[model samples]
Target: ETRHLTPQERVARGKAARADVPRSSHAEFVPPPKRTDPVEIIERQSATRVPELVPIRYSRMSEAPFRFYRGAASIMAADLAETPRSGFRVQCCGDAHMLNFRLLASPERRLMFDLNDFDETLPGPWEWDVKRLSASLVIAGRANGFDDAERARIVSSTVRSYREAMIRFAGTGNLDVWYAKIDADLLESLLASRLHGTKRGQKNLTRAMAKARTRDSLQAFDKLTETVDGRPRIAADPPLLVPAGDLLPDVERSALERQFRGLVERYGRTLASDRRTLLADYRLADVARKVVGVGSVGTRCWIFLLLGRDDQDPLFLQAKEADVSVLAAHVGTSRYPNQGERVVSGQRLMQATSDIFLGWERVEGIDGKQRDFYVRQLRDWKGIAMPERMRPRDMQAFGQLCGVTLARAHARSGDRIAIAAYLGGGDSFDRALTTFAEAYADQNERDHQALIDAVRAGRLPAEELPAA
Candidate 1:
């Protein structure tokens, strides 16, 4: 059981694997050809114009992508109709899975946690976020080794809380929505109250809280930097992130710099005037290439670090690569002309207190490639919770918290009355979605395994993702 291969043997095995190109029987994905068919692209986007709700039926069972990525966009679009009975749709994160919610430090030094991931964020039905979040609970539960019946119970509880919270939001005043938050102290206390098994459990949670606090821009700087040849550059976490280079060729870099300047100015306008002043204190420090997330991995990304008078007063802004919204593929044309503009417009509409430095820009690469991106601070104070570690009881508690948070977010962004009316009364809507969530969880697991097989074979490269 403990046989160790010699270094020579390991090299030999690697070479053999490379030569044979091992394939898995279950893994069936043919990476689609680069999206061409401008006529089809135009038609799909044109189709997106219909106001009626689209349905997420079946994905083109391509063997190309081991996991669902852009294809999931249809799901986001389809779920839009599920918005609560009361509210008008708000700009939503578009992928508000429970795992995406996390803790972060606000400039005021308050420790807060909410929706922290936004790769798939967009303006969509407020219900889309809730459905996504609930579905994630079911999927994550299965991944955590829960039985089907248990997974259903978890999804039911999760969506029930989401439904109940929406009702509260529907009746609440705008002021109530604006002031809502679950700060770290209250969160820690709540967790402590719920995890009543033993003193050890209390201690473990307290330790976790402490760890979440130190997750800020300063922390990101240290982790991402190292001295190279007596100079500091971002440590290369290849295929995940790399220090941005100004090396897109001379003429392209010049034009890019000019466009980027315009972007900074436009983005600053998206924030409060006061926040703009704070950003002006720090000049751009460095920019680098960054790859992030399973869905967003291949998109062009840029990370910029800024310095104030001191390193402690730093700002990290990431200009993530933006692509055409999958929603557009079905929904039709956007009121906004540009996709980059659409993204920024959506974020401002959704988030209560958004980054002042939010803006959009486009530039042509030296390779004659055109890219669109929206920029924002890289790391202010950010916190992320490990979803892979939840027990059934913990999931219950977390699900309730997610419900509270989702309602607050949706209430801020969308029309609350229509959604509240749709949700009607009680747990019926919640139960219906819960049933669907359990079914989808099974589908997600099979897809995840497909991805795993692709990785095991030579089909996909191992990107530096957190191992579950």
Candidate 2:
């Protein structure tokens, strides 16, 4: 085992990294001569997903450049492989775009702001996540009709927040760093100040928080289920939400339910004894195949409804198929053999807290094929950010929150001292990333247009859904 270095030595090591890979080197983004076609990457990924739902994925991505960026994590993974690195590795949220940062409830029911999606998580260069996030801000800013200067300022401020936060974490104790979190009260105060202390801004924040609290399993039970013969069943909304029974004949459906029950029991074994016992109180009532997110639409996702004592006390659990991380092809395969376990482990490592039901299992589908899945509560005070609806100041404030949250997460798993020392008190890294973000945003627009062209031609099928 390597001996632990002194704090001064660690700082020196970080400074040494800058000589080998200067911080300014991150600004460069020239697509290689042999760069692979972005559309081809999407098609390759689609091969492993549900065939009918692939069109929905394509259609959703075709809506805007920002939307396309959300679904094109694989494409960005390829591009990120070509970027500069600080030689520091962390458990990265591989698709750490602006939208992936959101408000989620902790197990203690305290609201917190943190990275909500870990579908593409892996241990890789920390810069990859920073780049992904910075580029997303530019794309989102463009979507919101912000000018170039304003976009650059927002990206720079966000990157600066990350650098400054990392520096602070570097000076703090290990336990202190691990215990750090951005709770709801802190977020509200930051937002209030960032919004110029306006009453409308405070009111809007209050309304959004109130709305989030009502999005738990009970609320989902009301909106997503209906009483049928004195029993509750998940309502079928075809192409998006389809009941499992509707997908197969009676005989096959019965067998599928049996397999799902066994899978749930096996998954529960992976959780703590207390959580497992708590889960035992609820009995599975129904299962439904649900399409979720822009990139995740084609993946095999299931929502299970479980009843506790009576139909009124319901718990909804989601089991989402976990494929290999997009970063796997470039960085390396995960240490965990099961992809679902890979996701669960990464989430546990990075998040301040995780869902009580978070666990994994491998199940054989009705088609006799086996797949890995990570299970969690279907909904629990989850709130998503709307980038297109954000003003410049609002986006900037949201970006800062994401930056600090990401820094906290990285500090938990990586060399915080070296990373922070490398960043120093200068703004060189922040400005360089701003340049990189703009250049990558241009490249993203071109890629999005390519998808639109493919759909117009006969190359790709796209089914546009009705507006909500």
Candidate 3:
């Protein structure tokens, strides 16, 4: 058993840690010596991905600086390895950029704002996530034509919210802090305050939340599935959504069904007894290869369409391949043999509410290798805040929301009192991070150009997609 300390003692310890590494030290951004080539790092990650679809990953990444940053977690990891730290750690969202923070439905059917991606989650310095979020604000602000002052304010707002939220958690009861979450209503209220009390702002907010509510499994079912010869199956959208029959020519459909059933059973065993019982009512109807988000483009992701009693009641489950987190090389390997377990464990530790059917399993690939994957409900009111659509004020408020959400997640696993003390009750930490964000955004642009240069030089293949 571990000894308990008074809250004051924890705060003192955190303040002491700051003396060893000053709060201002975080402002500096230095690339480590003999840094590995970012393009080469991307190639290494792509080696395990589907061979023909690898080009799509590069193509998506080459779109803009923010998009490039999303896929360049490996590059940022190497750079962050050289930054100063206070040594406190949390289950960091190794790639917690703006786009990764989104809306998802809680078990009670309430929409929540939380970190939605966890392909690269791991226990590491909490600053890594904050820095990535800060840089994302600057990069995305530039895309939106926000001036430097506006960009700096957005970054500062993010850090300020994080600092304040951490202090709030520190003062609260342990259980209270653990149970805390940023729900859609609370988030909308906060965003309204940031909108300067405008009627149109509230109207826009109501409209967006309403749209998010409509993006559940039923909506996805209508858009992604169709009847083929009186049987409903997932449609084929070549290079994006391909059925198992199209993906594996040699394997028979019956054999594929057996393999999937066995793997799903393995996944179900990892869920709670009640959840497994709830899942047992649904039978697998179809499976498809699904290309997902910017960073996760090349990974092996599959969608399973499950039906209960009749076609009207449906459930969609996504099985996404999990590999060693980008932070693993710098922060040490996870104890779990299965990487999917690492992702699922970290997500549970950080999120106040998680998906009902979340679980993990290792399955043999068509290439004869055993790969780890985590499964979850595919569309539980999932929605993203588009950077291109948000005004400067909206982005600032969104930044603060992400900051607060990230702080709550860190507080669950790290010492809240200590972190709050280290940050102090001032603007020093926020200003320092703002400086870092500005510098790093410049670096991201250069790195993005390098990828473009590679494409121009015929070093990498890329294709442009039509804008939405």
Model 1, range 1-468, lDDT digits (tens) per residue?
101444345334433432233211101222225524322332253243211111110111122221342234444344343322222346677767776677765556677767665545555655566666766777667657777777767777777676677678766776887777778787777666655555655666667667866766788888887666764456776545555453344456445556555556556664667877877777665566765543444456677777778655566788876667655544454676556667777655555455556777776655667766788767655656555677777776777777777777776766554455455565666666776565455544455456445446644334333422
Candidate 2's residue-wise lDDT over 164-198, tens digit each?
Answer: 99999999999999999888899999888778887
TM-score for candidate 1, residues paired by index = 0.74
Per-model TM values vs. the true structure:
0.74, 0.98, 0.97
> By lDDT, is 1 or 3 better?
3
Q: Tell me model 3's lDDT, rounded to 2 decimals.
A: 0.89
Better of 2 and 3 by lDDT: 2
lDDT of 3 by residue, 167-275 (tens): 9998999899888997987888888888877776677778778888998889889999999888789999988899999989789999999999888888999999999
| lDDT ranking of the models | 2, 3, 1
Any runs in candidate 3 off by more than 4 Å, and if so which? 1-3, 466-468
Q: Quote model 3's TM-score.
A: 0.97
List runs of model 2 lying over 4 Å from the truth.
1-3, 250-253
lDDT of 1 at 406: 77
The Cα RMSD of model 2 versus the native structure comes to: 1.2
- Model 1 segments more than 4 A misplaced: 1-88, 189-205, 228-231, 246-270, 310-313, 368-370, 449-468
Worst 10 residues of 2 by lDDT: 1-10
Clashing pairs in 2: none
